[model samples]
Target: MIMLSDWHPDIIEFIISKMQNPRILRYLLENTEDEQIKKAAQDKLKFTPLTAQEQDMYQGIINYKQIPGLGGFSDKIIKEAEEKLRTGGTYSVHNSEFLTGANISVCLTSDFMEAVENDEEYSLRFPDVEKYDEEEMKFYNENWHEIGDVREWEQMGYKVRTYRKMRAKELWNLINVCATYSAEPGIFFIDNANDMTNAKAYGQKVVATNPCGE
Candidate 1:
């Protein structure tokens, strides 16, 4: 009998190396011994790799989605990530400029959020009404990542959701040109709260900002 509560990777791996039972691999619950999990992760080793992607690099990939020209690292990115979730598609991201300063703010609306949740193609791209009134819809918007540098208790999507639109590679390139220092876009999703909660009162149409809100 193996304890299933342990999370120790080495211990579990050791046990799996010895055990050949298939049923034991099934029905693995949490709080169980690390050995049990090691057995499971190893049993499915062919699927889920023993490696994990760095969050910052992943965050960079996610941040790219916020950029104006970029298409949120392409919807297929998430698909690929999910498919390779086991293989661990994570790759290191290296770029000093991308993280030099956290500026150029951006925000997301509830409607956009709905799209991302329901529609696979829907982008959390900022959708504004009065802000784009007669203005170009390209990078013609303002930055609206959040109400201020001071925000709390907001219902957030995946942590990456804050940087939802942006992705690692694209952000690296933009950093080369220094979008972080200029527009200083802050990335976040609070549109549903804004429209429903009346945070900024942009009104029904919707509005967006490149690095700052209107």
Candidate 2:
């Protein structure tokens, strides 16, 4: 057998798309230094049938970015963040029970939280505001510039929406649902996080936090 470990990370990653052996995928996940290989292993594991123990291990890889006791080395709580870098939100996880057990903290903006509460489709990273109402449109146009660099939005001519205040009951209901499943997602004011960050001067904004809220 040509050992998977003998191959380079890039080769192993390419094979990951064609290979289905759980054992080899697990080995790559546990041993690989290249994040591309690690993430590819994770993507394969998501569809491959796993034992209970293996499922737990897979969830750990998904949440590996911010293991509770570990430091902030990875970028985010799920593959969605990784997907953004690779494909620009073309492939994103819509929902997952796995995230509840992944043990990663998530932060949602007011507009996103409201959309989820109303069971409407929305995106913070790849925003589309044309479907929104005039009020929401105005809200986005007024605040989008303050939260992040306005140059990109202006060039795209897409005014990203934000909520001045979210409905309390809707917000609490979302919280309760996550809490019930022990999928505790911490809520933070996007505007507040952006306003307080020193990175604003550098044209960066705080979109999310680490497991420790750093």
Candidate 3:
């Protein structure tokens, strides 16, 4: 066991962030003067029912949901999970302290473009769109991996193209939100990156770049 005195305030706050063990948490709660750490500890005590095992494995599993924008998870599922966790349910958040401080980058392509073209208010929320060159368009077209049935749109005589509007309104929305919260979400032009990567010859798509997008 790491001694309480040996741990820095930040480390103590990190332990508080992962307050799965009430005994250890209570010890920290009594020892620490940080309000945020204390509040986190209190929240854990309020939401989680104490068991002999400390951590509720099954409850954590049932309450699991991925964070949206950060992941491709739907809003509905995340909402349901939040509801569950809100009312005396347990959820395991790996490296929860990372939420406090971590270098995170978000990538988007097709969904962003679609929102900009179709959603009027969404479009007005950000910068104006500009046309991409032929080469850029070709790369944009190959960026997002198509899923589900495309035949229906084709049969209906609808243009089932991906690069019709290469707008960054939705991406801007993400950037703005991150900016508001003082979070770092470095933009990665995944489509262009993938097209230019030497990994293409080896039959690999570069879905994400390095932390610095190098």
Give me the displacement of residue 202 in model 3, in angstroms: 1.4
Pitting candidate 1 against candidate 3, the one with the higher TM-score is: 3
Tell me the whole-model lDDT of each prediction, alpha carbons only: 0.34, 0.46, 0.43
Once fitted onto the true fold, the runs of candidate 1 whose alpha carbons sit more than 4 angstroms away are: 1-92, 103-106, 123-187, 196-214
**Candidate 2: stretches off by over 4 Å:** 1-97, 104-106, 110-156, 159-168, 180-183
Q: What range of 10 consecutive residues in model 2 has the weakest lDDT sum?
A: 1-10
Model 2 / residue 158 / CA error / Å: 2.6
Tell me the tens digit of each residue's lDDT in model 1 across 7-99: 111322322333222223332322233343444434543322324344445555555555775444676674454445433542222232333
Q: Candidate 2 residues 83-177, lDDT tens each?
A: 43333223222133333333333343555556666765432232357676787678677876454433356465765443223233433443444
Ranking by lDDT: 2, 3, 1
After superposing candidate 3 on the true structure, give the runs of residues whose Cα lies further than 4 Å from its correct spot.
1-98, 117-171, 180-183
Q: For model 3, how does the per-residue alpha-carbon lDDT over 8-42 read when each residue is reduced to its tens digit?
A: 12322333443344444455457554455456656
lDDT at 199, model 1: 39
